[model samples]
Target: MKIHMTRILTLMLAVFLVIPAFASAAPTTKGSAADLRSALGNLLGEHAILAINTMQKGYDGKADFADAAGALNANTDELSQAIASVYGDEAGKSFNTIWSSHIGYFVDYVKATGAKDNVAKQKAVDNLEIYRLAQAKFFATANPNLNEQELAEGLKMHINELLKAFNSYVAKDYASVYTTEREAYAHMLMTGDALADGIVKQFPTMFTGDIMNNPASDLRQTLGQILGEHASAAVFAMQKGIDGAPDFDQAAAVLTMNTNDLSNAIASIYGADAGKAFNPLWSSHIGYFVDYVKATATKDNTAKQKAVANLEKYRLAQAKFFATANPNLSEQQLADGLKMHINELLKAFDSYVAKDYKTAYTAEREAYAHMFMTGDALSEGIVKQFPAKFETTTPTVPTSPQVSTVTMQLGSKTIHVNNNKMMMDVAPFIKNGSTFIPVRFLAEGIGAKVKYDKTTNTTWIMAGDDKLAFWIGQDTMQLNGMNKKVGATVFVKDGRTEVPLRFITELLGWNVAWGKDKATIIMTKAMAPASAAAHNMATDMTNMSAGHMSH
Candidate 1:
């Protein structure tokens, strides 16, 4: 599938990458964890997509099904080889055999659906159940980390999801088809990640870092997944539109899902207003691309040129949006990358229109892969812009009082205080560029006394020697009787009075850290700075030394 840039998809990558802030406790390493997991995801996701297209074509008795099936088989081989490369040639061959069985069963089901043979379909389903057991066993035998029953259950879900999409397609429920198709594709990515995790554990020396907790690496992987899906969705939608295919509306609707996901992603990182503003600009290029497709289909050169010109405007607009949002991002690099994304998408579509299927497919792959580069470049810029957000320092710093970390998800009712978990009526939320958590959490979790005075519309908190007072909708808060302006005003949300997290915590000589991963707040309690703690220790030692001398 060609890239839409996938227009907003580039933005989508930027949006999704900002999520998963607590991917791992380990530092982001491209070598073992990120690269391997992403590589597997790429191949597995591609396989699921190709299989869907191929099966659909086969059901329709389309000639291109052969080539599409070949692509799917190639992916299967690559996956086997990846396993073999880690284990041995025999292992690879065994994986191929077990994997091939599942694909064969799916093909049988497709053929049965085409022939209107319910019995054949049931037989195919039965065969898939057997294939699931074998596939699960193969993986379980390969690694102790992978549970057989769990693998079997996951495989069943995979089988059922694909069948559901195919059945929906057969029934002409295009919306459900695309929706389930997306779920199936995502499921494959999870499968790839699971395999990577087991392999990484099996050979710890071969991999450098953990996969689940590295926020930066998760950013890279998630960006690639979202952007790659965008490319495929755009390609499918554009093709349907150009062909006047019955599923065009459904395909386009799925594309809209991508747009919303991207917009929400942007909102999660940038802000609600930024995401709202970003959606229209980000979606404009897509409409422009549709114009290009419409023009191309009608052989209207002038209209096509106009569409291309508009895309150029979109490219600049997209670059500017990111640049304006983040000065750390390089406009030149973004524009160049977006230009390549646009060109490859256009090239793929043009090739498909000319009946040059090979060229079209090749260009589609390029467009999909290019988004990974975009993700990498954008993630680097964002990481540079917000280093504190990604920093996860363990082994708390030395202070007179031990530092205790509190981890809170943006909208979750649960909060993690050091090793303990507590649930609150209200969750943390971002307001005016700061996170706000419930005041009661400070008292219950961190051994602080907090009170809300309904008459005065004020709240007070005392953590050790630190005392802080703030008023609702107020910009200034009194810290130890001295008022200080904060990034956000204290306010009431969801029937709870919320204070600016950093302003209140950091004021008490504590540290506040949150994530690009959906605004996860990690506040550390530090009663005294290390310098003050050291000075106190030295003074006490000197007094003791003087007393010894006097004695």
Candidate 2:
């Protein structure tokens, strides 16, 4: 298969180079901007997600590790194909070799973690650093528009982000692991866009106008990203949900966050009321899917049918909701699209339940890729509806914050994190004389990592080197993994877990304060602490070994 791929890449390069002016050979460019950007973003983002997922599976010695890794290799080949198409056969060859080497290094890191071999892990890291330079240099040498230094820095960040997520996973810093992993995924989109830009610049006649400079295209690709993420998160959540997997809650949390992003985007474009109404409409479908999975687990056909009926209702309602918001979007077309989504998800889930993993994997990819089409359609309608907001305007990239602060008013459904308004399904309320609300997002805001284990109904928080864990309905919290007496027990409300806001925040290295009115709580993360080293220390190291350890 590898040799066959090589020959195919060589052929692609020959065709690209041999045709200098193939007016008879070049493709048309009507929506080339959106096409190229979405294509690159899709493949590159998948690479990040698959790589990290493969690494975790490898580390865990999961039964599906082989399947995950195989999927990752398939992605690598596709990426190389993209490179080959742009940079010709030789660059593609070099990219595959270097890229494969880095993935091998990551594999080695995971293996070393299993063996508790710190030296081997460091060796992997050192090899990765060398691969980083080679990768950047290769790209720079291939495309004059791409800078060697800047490319190297981006490569370095990529390496650091992937490693940091891996190490955080090892240290059980689940919140930051997801956060860093997501940042890593987002970082790859930037890389893809840069790569796409360089290619379009070098071969303008082939690719047409600047895809990199269009805001409308940006909206399209951004929507593709989050929408694809929603598909992925939903699939994984279903898989975990059926298995009662340890990370099931985390998977669900990911789905919820994706919903928040989609809803927020809706709010930004349509109106707050539309976004607000959209949440339950969106969440209802998720719940129905959950029901489907549960029914399938018990072989309850009637329950499964009922779940399907609920989803059908959701599909029609959601379609109308969008059509009502903008005339450019047709209710029938949207209903058709929603039907496709539902079928794809059900197929993926059903395949997995039957242990047909190969089909399940393919179906999952199909579902995910379909969302890009959905995004393209939705973005087109939106851009058409509000040309003044999207077509001519450039969206600014958000900069990293200097300080992160969050405020919550007692008995309110809204919270402000870094001055950004976030609405929760459940409102903050007094329980046992303590203000109670969800802290997963809040703790994450203050540079803390949060993890929820579904099996035990426990939530864990990590900051710098400090750790705290508590089980639902338990009065004792574990400080640094040891049981400590805490008078408060977290309780689940409205299908969301609520914790004592002040206690949980303080435990995760945040300073808590009450406003003069005594109804508002403010949480701020202050001072400097060692973040999970992006360079990453040996995660599996134990006992007394100072030969290669760093704090």
lDDT of each: 0.68, 0.68
lDDT agreement of model 2 with the native:
0.68
Compared with the true structure, what per-residue lDDT tens digits does model 1 show for residues 325-412?
8988888878888898889889888887887777776677667767766766766566566655444333344524566677888789
Across 68-135, the per-residue lDDT of candidate 2 in tens digits comes to: 77777877877777677766677777889989999999999999999999999999999998998899
Error of 1 at 95 (Å): 1.9
Best candidate, TM-score-wise? 1
Instruction: State the lDDT at 431 in candidate 1.
Output: 48
**TM-scores, each model vs. reference:** 0.68, 0.66
- What TM-score should be assigned to candidate 2? 0.66
